[model samples]
Target: MIDDELRARLESLGGLDAGPGSLAGVVVIDVTRVVAGPYCSMILADLGATVIKVEHPDDPDYTRTFPPMLERDGADAFSGFFAQYNRNKLGVTLNLRHPEGKVALERLVAQADVLVENFRPGTMDRLGLGHERLREVNPRLVYAALSGYGQSGPYRGRPAYDNSAQATGGLWSMNGPAGGPPTRVGTIIGDLAASLYGVIGVLAAVRHAERTGEGQLVDVSQQDSVLTLTENAVVSYTTEGIVPEPLGNQHPFVRPYELFACQDGFVFFGGYTDKFWKISCEIFGAPGEFDDNPDLQTMGARFDDAVYAERVKPMVERWFSGRTKAELEALAGDLVPLSGVKDIAEVVADPQIAARDMVVDAEYAGYGSLRTFGSPVKLDRTPPRARGIAPDTGEHTAAIFRDLLGYTPEEIEELRAAGTI
Candidate 1:
C-alpha cells in the first residue's frame, strides 16, 4: 500500500492535468516486452494514449535488462533498448501468477480501451486473460495480438524473431546480390511491418467499437506482414510462374535502373522510357554505334542484366568515374530520378531531417539528454510528441494502484508484501 505521503503526492497531481494528445482519453494496457507490440503501443502513446506497461520486478521486460543501462541511485535506471520503444507510458509490476496480481489486471482490463500482447498463442489463455475472457470483462475492449504466424495456425506456437519471419515469408529470397545465399534484410523489417499493421488493425477496431459498442480482436502476424511487403513476388509467381530473385539494385523490368558510381558519391538512377534512355546516352556521350543502334536501345535489350553487364555498363562506368557529383547533378540529377547514397551520419546531418524533426532530444532525471528518433507521422494541428522518457520498471505502480484502480493503501501494502504489486 502507498504511505500517507505518497497518497497526498498523487492527489496533488490531479490539478496538473496535461493537454490531451490526438489519442487523448484512450487507455492502453501494454503487456508486451520487445519490438513489435511495444512499437505499436509507442506510436499510440505518441498520439496521446495513456499507455500502462505491465511487467514484474523479479522478471522484468527483456529490453529493460538488455544493455547500455544508465545508473541512477545505484541501480539500473533506463536502458537504450527499452527507452527506444517504451517512451510515453506508465509502468507497473504485476506477478500475474499471484491471485492479487491477476485480480488487479482484471480490474484494469475492464477499464481499458485496448490491450496489446505478443505472447505465444496459448500463453494468455493459460494466464486466464485471453481475448474471450477480456471481452466478457469489457465488450468494447480492442484486443491486439502481435505474433509470428498467428493465434490459430500450425506454426502458432513456434518461437520466432525478425529473422525467422523474414526467412519464412520470402523476404530472404529477395534481398542481397544474385547467386548469393539468402540473407535477411539489414533492418528488422519483419518486426516493424508487424508493428505498423498492428496499429492499423487496432485503430480500425477502436473506430468500430465507437460506432457499434462491439470490440474485436486485431490479430497481426509478422510473417504475414512480411508477405505484404513482398506482394509483387507473390503475384509474379501466381500469374507468370516467375520466382523473383535478388538482382541487387537493378530493376527487372527497367533498363539502366541501377547504381552508378561518381567521383565523389554513389548515385541511383533509372533510365527506362525512350525519352529517358536517349537522354542517358547523350549525357554519357555514348559512341555512335551504341547511341544510334535501335537493337540496343529498347528496354527489352537493356533489361537483360547479363547483356547490360557485359556490353553497356562498362561504358557508363568509365564515363561516371571521370565526373564529379556536382557535374552529374548538373547533367542528369535534375531531370532523372536520382538520389545520393547517405550514411547514418550524413542522414542525421541533412537539413531536411532536422527541419522535419526526425530526431529529437530525450532527457531523463538520472540520465543526461540523448538524441533519438521522433515520430514519423506529421499532423498540421496536432503533431505527436514524446510524453516523456520511458518509465523505469514498475515506476508508476503506486500511483496507478491508488489513483486509477482505487486500491486502498492497506490492500496495496498487502499485495506488495505478497510480491503481487
Candidate 2:
C-alpha cells in the first residue's frame, strides 16, 4: 500500500516542482567511483534517490582529484568530474578496515534500498562487504556491481578502464572511417553504456525487491555493454559470413545517408525510406534516374556502395555543393531527416538545445555559474531537477552520523579521532 504522505512527497518534488522526482525516498549507497559506477549513481540521484557516497578513508574517489577543479581561495574545492557526477548526493568517508566503520556501513546497507559498487571481482568479498553478506543483512537491498568485465569471467580480475573496454569490445574493431585504421568512438561509450545498463538492472531489481522482499545481484560489464552496441556489425559477420568494415559517415543499410558537401559547409541526409529517397532524388533533379531501378529503389540494394556511389553520390554531391547550408536547409530540412553539420560552437548556440533545456546554468558558490547538460528524460508527473551543487568531501558526515546512526557528538568525535570515519 502506498503511504499517502510519501506518495504526496514523491509526486510533488518536495515542493520544488510540479511533481517530486521519481525514486524519492529511495536510499542508495554509492560505493562506486569514476565513470561507470558514479555515473549510474548520478542518474539515480537525478531521479531523487538519497545517494550517499561512501569513500575510503585512505584513498577516496580519485575523481575528486581530477583536473579542471573548482578553486576557492587558491585551494581546490571540487573537480569538474566530481561536480558533474556527484551532485544531489551526500558525501562521506569511512575506513572499512576498522570494525566500527564496517559496522556503520553494514547498518547503512541494512537500511538502504540499493548499493552500487565497481571494484574488481573479489575486492568486495575481501573487504567483507560482498553482495551475499549485504543481502543477508537486507534481503530487499538491490546490489549492482559494475566492472570492465563480468563478475565471473577470465578477465574478471584484471583491472580495466574506459579505454580498455573500448579496445577489447567490438566497438573499436568496427568504428572509424571506411577502410581506415581502427578509431575509438569520440565519447566514453564503454563506461556510459555500463552505467545505462546498470540503471536498468537496478530499477528492475528494485521492483522485484519491492514485490518479493528478495534482492538480487546486477552484474554489468563495460565490455559487454560496448559489445551490445555492435549489434549490426556482429550480426553481419556471424550470420551472413560477411566481414564488416568501417564506412565513414555512410549508413550500412541505406543509400544517400552520409553527409554531403555544401557551398558553406556539410549537410547530412538520412532519407533512407522509399518515399524519402524519392523526395531526395527529386530534390537532386534526378527524378526518373532511380525510380525504376531496383538497386536504388530498395533499401537492401542501395546498401551496395558501388551502385550508390556510381549512380547517386555524384548527383547528390553536385546538387548539395551547388547550394549553401542555409539554402539547403531552407529547401529540404522539413522534407527529410536533414541537418547541417554543426561544430561545438553552433551546438552550444543552437536554439533547439536551449528550448529542450539540454544546456542550463548551474550556480555554485565558488564556481559561480557553470553550463551543464540537463537531464534528458522528462516525466509527465515527476520532472527531474538538480537539487543543488555537490557537497564537499564528507561535507554531510556530521549530519548523517547524528541523524542516521543516532551518534552522539562524543561518539562522532571518537570515530573521527580513531580514523574510522
- The candidate maximizing TM-score is 2
RMSD of each: 4.3, 3.2
Give residue 324's error in model 2 in angstroms: 3.5
lDDT of 1 by residue, 1-421 (tens): 1234433343234221134456767778999988989999999878867778999769988877767766668655678778889887788899888878888998988878899999988888998889999999999999999999998779999999999899999989888887777667899899999999999999999899989999999999999999989857888899999988887777656767788898888877676766777777777765664456777777788778787888667756776888776687678877776566778998898777999888787877667875678888998777786535787788888878887789998988988999997
Could you tell me which residue pairs clash in candidate 2? 11-20, 12-20, 13-19, 13-20, 178-248
In model 1, the number of clashes is: 2
**TM-scores of all candidate predictions against the true structure:** 0.89, 0.91
- Clashing residue pairs in all predictions, respectively, total 2, 5
Measured on C-alpha atoms, candidate 1 has an lDDT of: 0.81
In model 1, how large is the Cα lDDT of residue 234?
A: 86
Give the distance in Å from residue 213's predicted Cα in candidate 2 to where it truly belongs. 0.6
Specify the poorest-scoring 10-residue window by lDDT in model 1. 10-19
